[model samples]
Target: MKKNVVIGFLGTQMDAGKRRKWRPSVQLCEHPDFPVERFELLHDARWRSLAGKIKAAIQSVSPGTEVLLNEINIDNPWDFEQVYGALFDFAQNYGFDDEREQYHVHLTTGTHVAQICWFLLAESRHVPAKLVQTGPPRNNTPDIGTLQVIDLDLSKYNALQQRFERVSGEYNTLLKGGIETRNPVFNALIERMEVVVSNSDAPLLLVGPTGTGKSDLAARLYELKLQRRRIKGRLVHVNCSTLQGERAMSTLFGHRRGAMAGAQSERGGLLKEADGGVLFLDEIDELGLDEQAMILHAVESGKYFPLGSDYEVTSRFHLIAGASRDLAGLVAQGKFRADLYARLNLWTFRLPALRERPEDIAPNLEYEFEKVGKMLGNQVAFNADALPAYLRFATDPSTPWPGNFRDLGASVQRMCTLSPRGRVTLPMVQDEIATLQRIWKDAHADADAVLLAEVLGEGAAQIDLFDQAQLASAIRICRESKSLSAAGRRLFAVSRLEKKSRNDADRLRKYLEKFGLDWAQLVQ
Candidate 1:
């Protein structure tokens, strides 16, 4: 007898037209022996067109098999659980015959909502379900198969584990073995969190500069917590910068029906949605003082009153907050509340900047190269020159990397994508460095110019003629080419005499001396 299967595609819209028809087209081959029935539970009316196409496909595959294409209006948060429950009920009532055959739910789509709902239903019913995705073929095309699902809540945890393993493998492969070979500081923090996560429910504060992977670390912690508990709860990540005024309250504590003018129905806030797991607050410094107090109260008491509702909702979510700037500074400036800071500082871990971890730069570059190459479907590799140049750029103490690892990653990706023959050269590195310098100068043009003027005195006027940026650019070019003429040619593309005659070389020399560039040994 053929196995009974129920598949749920859980996203806002599940219309056959918008759906990746090719994905389902390939998915149908999974159960070649069993008679498969397809169902599309769309959360929006917009997906009707896609639904029709899916119905047609089902008809082609199995002429008489029942295919249910339904639309659910989900304007509020409560509707999700209700809609999900109804879908499962509908599936069991129409498709599954428990006495005749074993029913298995297969979630082929990569929608997180569907995955969560299916997980809950599968666990409740004690039914076997598997997640399947397409994998690259041994030869050319990609193949489809089931990835491991040790436990239902293990998805996030497993993903982090896999990522860690992959990154570790790349480090070992590239670095061979050296002191501080891996990101020991980051790994050690993770280890400490692993020990503390299960023991305490206090909020975790991941303090680090931007692009230091604070968000990533927070996610891994959430997964680790889930893996430890074997519980079902969603990992909800919210950027505090995106939430403003009323939206902040609604987003955190949820809203009641008619709570405000536009609130038509009741909704579950992120805290409630993330109950039993983790709520990662990125850019925590951006959160307003009132919101910070509310968050602190929730973290302290695990009780919050939803907007426009008298009833108080409770949460069991592990709060993990991250920020690019110093929270203590924000507290000092009266931007952030001290109480909230105290609560969040329970298990604080400050990630070291990329420049501090020069050992990990090469591995990070290699891993990033492979990642970008796979995404772009290109065979890209970094030449030996690329690593040294990137290392110098990333670890330069004088260089200001406001974006940190993210900026480095993006730069590497751009270089790989734009490089000819997938080979990064010294010129490519120089070009990128020049571009970054331009951006930096543009951002700090006023301040930089003032600083240069203050130092250069009478020469400051000449410095002012060409913005501080231009002055800096001229110096960089001169150093790179080891000749004023060549640097001028590269920077302005002007005739050698014109570039030299502009007094740019003299101004650059004076400015360099005034800034103590000689002391810094900036000039080669």
Candidate 2:
């Protein structure tokens, strides 16, 4: 059985009287429910006489209880720093054996400041003890007081536990740039990231289409780590596609003086600069084979050789790689290194494209509006009629946000810049909508022309615009499917229902023959 130990201040007035009638110390020792095996009395140096009296009284009440008086100097009992420091020093040196003893900190016999300090210590785990507050007897007789134990572990309390969870959720929302994203998949992704970011420094890979906020998420995650003191260095962002040849190698791994033709001085690489912080490599799939191999080595062993250097350098950093394309596909095609992919694939998060999250558009628009307003020093708001009109078009099924968040952000920037006197009127929204439609139409037309040209050479120019649209849809489905019949079933699902014989493959072949194209040619 564990011994019950009670530690408290010597209550100068409450435990001072020679008669044990109203003395709290005597009440604690004589309590029938709680039999304290040991008592540790803390008192000011001037209260030695009172401390001695309390110890004697406690012993008289319970002869089996061992009483020890500890002397502590407190210049001002009300001074938080002085009292807390004194108590903290005592607790630190006291050598508590929690395995064989249960500690109860008595809060009834101290100043309000002391009581609060003790509670803080126990709550923060500076002292492994439970807080126990004692009250005088309800009857006017000389009886034992009431003892209530308070466990400092907040998780045991439902309300406090819920509050912590709510705060954690709010923090994650902030990490996503305060957009209040309503997508379930996106919210769950953020929640998982919260745990991974706090616990591990392993490389994170973000896979998504371009403008899907990969870079933004990486930057925000770095900021979160910095705020939490998990990292001390700054964030080094690298757009891999923008780098080329020797510059790419030299940029990532520092170069010694005169390493290249234009090398005027030694340059410390981004990896070294990001030591103790985050290194976000956007479009990582664009990196060369050699760079990928070097990254793999660095990630595996926190060590890599800089350009034109014989000796290797060390850089311990959290790596976050972003890719708009399928890295696994690139790996299979031998364009990306499989080893590097495996290393970064440990924690992969796929950010959803804007079209996949229509519900988040309105909230994102508001967030973007606020951001632009702060940047331009002018708050902008959409008129009542314009807000719904813009949202209707933005959330429509046919409205393809090919560029994802980048498209939305650019649209907002253009409208806010053109809004008269910070008011986005209905006419302004109509003009923006028209501009977006024209842009999308032109983009689709260009894509169709390119697709047809790739398949039919110059014969693509002879195809009518009406046939081009239908042909492009067929070609896309065929390319995505494993076989011609599979693609046909999807394309002719409604039409095949009208026919008794569902020869989807033959129908698809005939459709291709009308354009003088074969299944083999279109699939290619």
Candidate 3:
């Protein structure tokens, strides 16, 4: 068995009481559980005599134990920095032989500041020892004292582990802007994102359709990093789509005076501005190949040559790229550099589109309304019936939310802006529904027009764009169904429930006749 060694501070006051018979260091040496074969006592230069008395008492109580005194000089034992530095230097230079001896740091005899420093050093493994705390004999009993050994490894403690888990959950909630998302996939994504953000400084690629909160998530992540002191500089956001040609180079990499035509002054680029911070590149897929190459170089090496400058500039910045388009597909098409894609592909998170997560629509709707209220400096709310009516339409499968969250946010803003007395009534919701339906219809009109031409050939030109969506949908449904009644029932699933006759075939026939087409002709 290895010999046991105890290292501690000599309590100048506590060890030298009025009688000077009982001392914490002596108690540690005499404790049966500790089996201390050696005691290394730390003391200030002014406390040499007191330390000598404590060392002699320890040796007298435990004759087999050897005592060594270490002098640690600090102006104030209560000064945290000085105490910590002294303890740190002592631990660094102390020749500890782990193979031959077991070490324990006694925490009973030092200033509170010194004790805290010892705990920090031990917990961080700077001391490579267990902590031993001693208490005086209770009721003047003829006992040496009470002794407790504490291991600083936090993983062994259940309460600390639970607290860490709770903190991680809070981080996930904060990442979602405090909205309790109901979608399991989205919740899981946020949880993983929180872990990634907490542990990594690598470039992050946020892949999702536009209006799915990529930019907002990136900004929130930057804010979290700022709060954690991981970043000391500002978040520099750049929309790659807005940059083009030489201007793109100059804007991203900066320009020197007279480096190129129309260049008059020295410029520090966005990368340099992002030093010690984060660079959020939105719509990064829009960047040209040459710019992509430079970005890869800068990301990999943190060094780049500015526009028309032969000298290299260095900017250490964390990167986060947002892409609405499939960068892998772009790479396959030779539009994006494969090497750069490889770098960013390491940590890729795809945000689900708003339409994909309908369960989130209600809560997000409330959040958007709150945001609009703050922005407008007044609160707006929907009437009881109007709120459900709008929610029903918004969450419907047939609703085309082409712009995702942006579409919903804009719709809410419009309703709030036009609401009478800050209350959105049923009529206003009905009108807004019609407006949104019209907008989506117009947005899909071109695609519908193509399908109409395929069905009608020369006759397609006669149909207006406004009617093409409805007519094309009808034609496509008629072509897909085995009969006109099946097609009509599907197209009027809800409306037919209200009709007593339910003669969907007749209704469908008349609708087709209005468009100068029959079910047979559509299927043919």
For each candidate, how many residue pairs have backbone atoms clashing (under 3 Å)?
5, 0, 0
Report the C-alpha displacement of residue 90, candidate 1, in angstroms. Answer: 58
- Candidate 2 lDDT score at position 240: 97
TM-score of 2: 0.64
Candidate 3: tens digits of C-alpha lDDT, residues 14-120: 78875445678888887775688989999889999988888888788899899999999989999999999999999999988999998999998889998899899
Task: Write down the worst ten-residue block by lDDT for model 3.
Answer: 14-23
Query: Top model by lDDT, which number?
Result: 3
Which residues of candidate 2, in runs, are more than 4 Å off? 1-153, 446-449, 454-524
Per-residue alpha-carbon lDDT of candidate 2 for residues 404-475, written as tens digits (9 for 90 to 100): 888889899999899759999999999999988888787756787888898888999999998998998899
The TM-score leader among the candidates is 3
lDDT of 2 at 107: 93
lDDT measured at residue 268 in model 2 versus the true structure, 0 to 100: 91
Which candidate, 2 or 3, has the higher lDDT? 3
When 1 and 3 are scored with lDDT, the better candidate is 3
Candidate 1 off by > 4 Å: 1-184, 444-524
C-alpha TM-scores of all predictions: 0.51, 0.64, 0.67
Q: Which candidate would rank higher by TM-score, 1 or 2?
A: 2
Clashes of 1: 5
